[model samples]
Target: MTGEYLAGRGAYILGLITKRIWFRASLFSVAAILTALVAGWVAPFIPYELSLTVGGKAVDNILTILASSMLAVTTFALSASVGAYGSATSTVTPRATQLLVDDRFTQNALSTFVGTFLFSIVGIIALTTGLYGPEGRVVLFFATIVIVAVIAITLLRWIQHLSSFGRVRDTIERVETVARRAMQAWAEAPHLGAQPPVAIPTGLLSVYPADTGYVAHIDVAGLARIAERYGLTVHIAELPGAFVYPERPLAHVSEAVDDKARMAIKNTFSILPDRRFDQDPRFGLIVLSEIASRALSPAVNDPGTAIRVLGAGHRTLADFVDTKRGAKACIHLRVHAPALTIDDMFNDFFRPIARDGASVVEVQLRLCATLSSLAAHAPDIFGKIARRHADAAKMRADDALSFEGDRAALHMSDF
Candidate 1:
């Protein structure tokens, strides 16, 4: 039980760290400082013959130049990043801004630039203070060269990244990638290592959340352990990514638990102001749909982008259904969780597109084709869900499309 709690806590902390750009930048900055310090300390132990005949003034000049240039570079990069974020929020879905902010390539490039700047500043201070001997200057000079190389590489990569940073296509791809990963994880463990949820027994006590927010993550392992300790069967009422209010029950325990146990169970759920895609596959799907809907809006009227997003959504659902084949259920948990249905996933991704793109014959035809493909490949339950959406989309197309030929062309053979 303790292990489960710690594991859950660790994962949450890691998620928090990854989400913040500064955490990684701070780590790299510290590493840069330590590298300089260690190299200076070790310099004297090396033989004088191996030391380069670099002058103090020369090393000082290089360090000064690096320090000043890096400062400007850091500022420019920060401004560019801010611009990218703002553009993304305004042009793309605002929810996608978080992903852009947390992007690994962009963050790493910025961190490298900032870390190099700090390294040079420290080296300059140490040099001016006469903290390093002749041998130390050699180490500092070599380190300076390496840092310059790193800075150049990072600058080049940052330039390339800027080209598409926060663009709609890039944001959609990022969201799709994240959503696909989440779907893979869920498909692998759809019940979250618990039996399929059943009706709460008549005597079981319902536990409500003290605060209201989206249920970001559920510590299923912790919940299972808590259920085991209390000799109770627990049924979760809310899934990760679900929004909860004070009145809604979070879970039901087979027997009444005391205040302490109730608190522990509540702790198993992590509530936050917004949903994340790492744990919530549905959130990713919704984000993709948002991007498509934005493109299909009258102001944008970009049916091509909407069509591309439909393909992405179709591919994601296809992968999800394919992964579920021959999958085994988790048998070891004491807590039960509700399973997400194909109908829900279909609605989450395609409903908005169907509504927003009703007037665009191209988008409507593409949506119906995607749905037909999914229906053909999906199992019986999922095929029905896909056909239902196809029919609904066709009805919407018939009502909104100006010409009967366009509406007739939107029909799916399977539907």
Candidate 2:
């Protein structure tokens, strides 16, 4: 089952690549031919190596041109194939997460497919043609292989980004789950009132005018800082922007949120704490502000030993600001225009939170739901951008198809 999932999904990802301009093998071929032609033109005449008359007709020049053309085509193909591998890996991961039943196994399969696919093709080419030889063709062939390897390495980082996403998704789920369970346990134990701590989800609250929306530029820094001070690890990594080689293409985010609390604090202060750490679900607290300062008290403790924190992200940020006097922080940039409104705000943050999760299955299901909503609302967004940027519009089509198909599968499973 695992192998089948890997092969099937990997192929699907590869199929996605075929539709993209970058994966069109012909371009690489053309480049190789051009490189050979240019090199041949500059070659000094050697009586032994270069002969205008070969038995009957002039052939050395013609052969050089022909070989160069072949080399160009081969080189282009090899270069483009690197992009193909990247696109394939990226596509397979998110789809498998949503479509496959067993996520861990799916992830393993996806990883294997990445390593195996690259190795098999390159390995076969190397084995069949002697990589080290006196023949120029053989030498050129090996060089082409090397170029392909470089491209593959450069592009495969997208797979790593996707893997990071999976890990982050898992961590966020735990944060939510542990918090929810802790709240429930606190409310149920002993003398709790009818109304427990009202826990709003992550994407909820009045996101400052600029903070709202599906656009990448959300005002998360304030919340991130608050999360840090409170002990939730915050590592702010950039989300993949428009299908480039992933690896968190963010340049310089003053602060990023991580799902781990201790790490968050450590990162915020830029200090390494003198303590060993493992992910423990026992650090929940409730804060009450007084005239002098804010007071934190243990609000809920689970019998099974789960600790959860209470308070919205924004409120936490406010607390951090109040306590710290003056500190650099994230603020919303408002755009008061006639076209946008509050519903946009609701969709921007709250909607995602309404679709909550605590496990991989739950996160996958929720992600599918959230993404579907975004796609339906913004179909032309990714479609238009991809079409304009990638020389081949097929890339746009494949991306749309993958996201759309994944959305549908998730919807079907809703039954």
Candidate 3:
């Protein structure tokens, strides 16, 4: 209710200003026209019988000439007002200015037209009703000029208030920077399965330096739930913690430690394959985390369990490499053991590429599946997945596989 009242007040104020300007311009035009009509048509016919007394002296001829000159002056003033309005409108209308004050050219033109028409009607009545005396014409002409001046001053003040050159320049610069970053992110992001680009805001979070490196904290559970609920087949790196960017890649973290932790996490009994696991359906990650290391201990580990654990770890590592940006990458570990698991997983995941020729088709398929899964359930996460896939595809083509200029190239588009 308060908001509505304020809005109403604002609108009323605007209307009042508009009406004032319009009436002023109209009256000025009318005054000018009246002067012209009186000098050109009425004054010449002023009968000698209607001689006016000026300064207590009979000065009929002098009075007539003076009145005619005033009329001419008023006419020129009115014409000038109209011309000013036209010029102002032209200057302000082309660019859609951020400041409303600069838009007054159009407003002034509208007001002038209405004001002029009203003035004409009033002047015509005043003249026809025998109210056409030298005194009356002079008074009306001066009043009209005053009105036009007042309105012009008000409009000029408004323009000055609306446009701050410094502010506008700053806003433009910021907008340009944001746009550039967005474009670059899109270009660099992965897009497996030829999926659309992810719409992540660049400045959504601030980067903070941690003990190891810079960390970017973000919640991924929301995305995970969305993906699961929607039955998406996309690959999502659901790290509730912040992503760490270290100075060196795989330099601070030990590959052996990571491998050991990952193996342990995998040995832990997986909730995914358990009957009681799906009861809550939310313990998927928890279950995996618990069984990873416990069930895969070197003393009593099953080969099958180990393979699944290794595979899952590899998938997570792939996702990290594909999506991560900048020079350094960091892993956050609220659960200390998982940090080692991640390192080991990453090492093992990439180690195979050195000896064997990496299968482009396999990688592409994995990327497609990951992106598709993400889109189906968690479109937001899916967008991220799709972005990483696209980036991976590009990397594979550029550095890993030499399929340049090959129309029959293996790309997400081909799938």
- Candidate 3 residues 1-415, lDDT tens each? 1111112223433544554645555655665555534532444454433334222122233334434443454454445545443432333221112222223443454344444444545555555566656544444444445545654574465355335322323222322232233222322322211122233333222222213422111122222233244333222122212233323221111122344333332222111112211111112222222223323344534333323433443333334334443321111111111122322322233222211222343434343444444445444434554555445544554565555543135453432
For model 2, the run of ten residues with the poorest summed lDDT? 288-297
TM-score of 1: 0.94
State the displacement of the C-alpha of residue 296, model 2, in Å, after optimal TM-score superposition: 28
lDDT of 2 by residue, 325-345 (tens): 111111212111011122332
Give me the candidate number with maximum lDDT: 1
Best by TM-score: 1
Model 3 collision count: 32
